[model samples]
Target: MVVGEFTQDVDVVVIGAGPGGYVAAIRAAQLGKKVVVVEKDEVGGVCLNRGCIPSKALISAAHHYEIMTHASNIGIQAEGISIDYGKVQEWKESVVKKLTDGVSSLFKGNKVERVKGEAIFVNEKEIRVVSGYEGSRYRFNHCIIATGSRPIELKPFPYGGRIISSTEALSLKEIPKTMMVIGGGYIGIELGQTYAKLGTKVTVIEGLDSILPGFEAEMSRLVTRNLKKLGVEVYTNAMAKEAKQTDHDITVTFTTRNNEEKQITADYVLVTVGRRPNTDEIGLDAINMKMTDKGLIEIDHQCKTSVPNVYAIGDIVPGPALAHKASYEGKVAAETIAGHPSAIDYKAIPAVVFSDPEIASVGLNETEAKEQGLKVITGKFPYAANGRSLSMNAGDAGFVKLVANQETGLLLGGQVVGPEASNLIAEIGLAIEMGATLEDIALTIHAHPTLGEMVMEAAEGALGQAIHQINRQIK
Candidate 1:
């Protein structure tokens, strides 16, 4: 049968209804523009459907299980604690469904049209969306591309049989007895620790000298210590050579720091080295769009592509591939499309890793500041001294480190590694964005017996006026 051709016109058409794409669509609609979103699969994309939400859900469950099994010191004895992983996955899927359904409802409430299909560019102002046997063309005044990214699979360890990616790991029906993680980045470490807490023998092989090379060595050291406590083996300065799979298990060969080759066999192998942009199959060249050698789209501060009527955001653009960062870029792109003069400013974007003890950071660290030729003063406060951390049975968990200007006392950056580090990094991020100084945070009286007081204590320590701990004034 021959298909008929029809074209629909809209004010804006957003491709890939991920966090970035959906946010862009809703915001464009809210700004009085008729918007239509085209997605190949689910509305919430990978972050809601697979990556962020599901991973965090599993992590929370694993954390609870770990705490219950080891809380005898706190007068709570949980004998014979067992995990029903199938039910855990069911609960995880329920959480995902609620959020994705909420996104669908928002699209309806905002009157943003959603077309389910794979989209290809016909030109800057026109696109064709095909779903199964039917195809439709869309003509728009403006377009935003937010297709996001997928995990990178190494040639030696293609994803099949015993070899898996994060997506497959999250949806596993049964927990593996043993697992091997290929990389030691946030994704690998996060999932590795999650399974370890749930009673799996885990091994991590990192090409760099340390896991999470993006963070400070001190912060990474804290996570390494926690991983050891969980009985997880970590190999830094190691290179993965190959993977061979059998009917029963998979074996991975790698070279160690001493240039010795070693092998480990496990029920499954997870490769989470990094993510590659989803730019190749979208027909970007049809519109002559500009892209980097790394396959990232080149866009201005306003998220405008080389094509005047086209724009891009999120993981497709250069920066850390974070869901929050993508959502922020979406808003900026939509506001700019609405003629609101919004531009991207990433001075205070925070990055968080939900490890055993979480690690979060924003802006520059001491080494970065010094490399940039800025004289910096540093302040450090431990969770051991905080009343809240001590009461919470995590006194020796982690600490807060603050970096400030030596002469002006301006807060430049901060790093937190411990319980609730993910939530605690926000205050420091706000301070950096608001141009708050050391005195600004220290002078503000924080409530007593709270974890947040550590921020103030750190600031006071920088000023040589710390009351809870010995003050070492930065000369």
Candidate 2:
């Protein structure tokens, strides 16, 4: 069957429906621009459907299950503690469905056209979208590429029934008796911890010398300790050689840093090494678009690609592969396309690890700060000393660390590893963005018995006025 070309004019077109693409489309529509969002899959992209939302849902369920099982020890009597994995999965799927539908309704409410198809660049000013099943073509003006990334598949361990990626891991039909996670990044740690709490014998293997390699060593240590307490076996400085499917188990062969080879058997293997940009199959080269050495779409400060009128954002472009980051970039690109001066300031973007206790940070770490030759003052307050953490029965370890300039007291960076660390790091990120100093943060009255007080305590400690802890006056 032959189909005729259909052309449609729009003020702005967004090519991915992930967090970035959808947000951009909605923002452009709010600005009174006729917008169309072309997505090959579901709206809300990976974050709402798979990556962030689903993973967090699983983590929350795991946390609840763990709490209920241990409720007796906390003086709450419970009987026949067990988990129905099937029901848990149903609940998780329901959450994802609700959010995805919400995103679709949002697009409808904002009058942003949602096209379900793969969009290819026919020219700088035109795009041809092939409907997945219908094989229809729709042309649009000024498109935004928000196509996200896919998990990087290791050559030795290809995805299959026994071997899986994060997407498959999230929708596991049944929890494995034993699982081997071949990565120590945030994703691996998060999923690994979730499974461990749910009664899976979980092991994490990392090629790096330490997990969370980008974070401070102290923070990583805290996470490691917490994970160990959760019964997760973490093997750092280890490389996976090969995986063999046995009659009853999957055997993973690895080499340790000390040149020792070992084997571990697990029912499931999750390969969460990292993600690669989804730049293939969209006919990028056909339009002569430039990409970075790392295969990310090359874009300027205004999110303009090498080709004019073709803007790209999200995982396809360079920067942290975070949903929020992509969303911001998407808006910037839309605004710039709308003739507004918008630039992305990458300095204040926050990164979070959703493992048990969680880890969130923004700006520079101590290592980066020291390498820049800036004298820094560091302060820390432990969760054990926090009143709220103790009351929640979640306070055993973890703390908040603030790094600032020694002379100017300007906040350089912040890290939090504890319950709701993901949420608590926001205040620190705001302070860094506002160039808040130690005194500025210390003077601000944080509510008592709250986790946020840790931020104030850390800042006060930096200024040598921490009232709750030992005070060492800065002279």
Candidate 3:
């Protein structure tokens, strides 16, 4: 039963309090706009509560566990190390709870009103929100929608007891002895690798020719090779047909690339194929908002929708549905709504994967630059050549690649597939955003005995100069 009725008039109303929504709300409030954020679930949204933060906590735990159990090579030995999944999950939940609570506190501190409910557009200027036992209406001069996306469920293998999504995988009580991961995207590979490190026999079947199809094959090769070391089997050009749930285990049927039928049995089947934007039933069309054929909201450079006073950001818009991307767009929308003349820019958006050695990329890679018919020069420096990597006993893996214009040496992009790739990509991303050159990076004095030195060395190589590695000419 609806328990309450209320009405609120505000300068701006932000929908879906995910990273994008909350950031937009806070920025709007800071700009002297009376802002209210409407969130159906928790304030932190899926990234903090379900996807990014929780998964990273679990991955960090698994990484530490691997380090503990496999430190014999470094003269550190442990007779046995076992996973306490209940405790691990408890710790993960605690981390998530802390971050979510912080988001709530920020909302209060920013003077942004919080309305707990599922909101739908009642008209171009108003929306109706229903919160469990309460209902309310809100009218706004401007509206911003930051509704995020969710994991897509397959038709044949619907999410349930034996079938699960990443959310369910993150909350598992015990580590499954065996698991089959369909769709070898970054999500599949990361989680599959995580469980494999924890002693789960992971089999990844991908419809593409290679796993992590979105990344460069050479970059993915490093991860796939490490997966082999972890005893995780991967099958490419494979199609998962259906799944059968039984009392003991789940049997998943698939067709191999050679057209041979095969079956893999696992405790559960984890599907990480892709995510669909959460753009349904929120009544966007009610506001005469323009949208793509696939339901993504249409917006201008400032994130303004066709309705002028309305805006959309994050997964509901075109681009990779990354949390940082959403957060960036949120700030743009908020600033634009506050009449700050802010605009969206995607030139330096970085993508990072927390796989075995980690992989990160920003700006244009060689393939993309070549496809665009831009003459480019590329250089690579390996972890083996970096003193820091060898000192850490990780010299056997990873490399840093720099892509730059052949004529101008303007830094085009960078690819890092090694330890701390996520952190290393930030410098190059900033360089690209600021339009720096290979000479700029090469001349900069990177700290000695650091992984970041590889970046500088790669820049030198791109300029046909050699210091740490032999310079190879690019035709």
Clashes in predicted model 1: 0
Off by over 4 Å in 3: 1-3
TM-score each candidate. Answer: 0.99, 0.97, 0.98
lDDT of 2 at 107: 91
Clashing pairs in 1: none
- Residues 1-475, candidate 1: write the lDDT tens digits: 3166589999999999999999999999999999999999898999999899999999999999988998997898778889999999999999999999999999999999999888999988899988888889999999999999999989999999999999999999999999999999999999999999999999999999999988999999999999999899999999999988999999999999999999999999999999999999889989999999999999999999999989999999999999999999999999999999899999899999999789999989889999999999888899999999998899998999899999999999999989999999999999999999999999998998998999999999989999999877457
lDDT of 2 by residue, 66-157 (tens): 88988987799988988889999999999999999999899999999988888887777677777633544445557788899999999999
Assess each prediction's global lDDT (C-alpha) against the native: 0.94, 0.88, 0.92
- Candidate 2, residue 76: CA error in Å? 1.8
Which candidate, 1 or 2, would have the higher TM-score against the true structure?
1
lDDT of 3 by residue, 66-127 (tens): 98888998998798688889999999999999999999899889999998889999999999
True lDDT of residue 449, candidate 3: 89
* Error in Å for residue 112 of model 3: 0.9
Candidate 1: how large is its RMSD? Answer: 1.0
Tell how far residue 451 is off in model 3, in angstroms: 0.7
Best by lDDT: 1
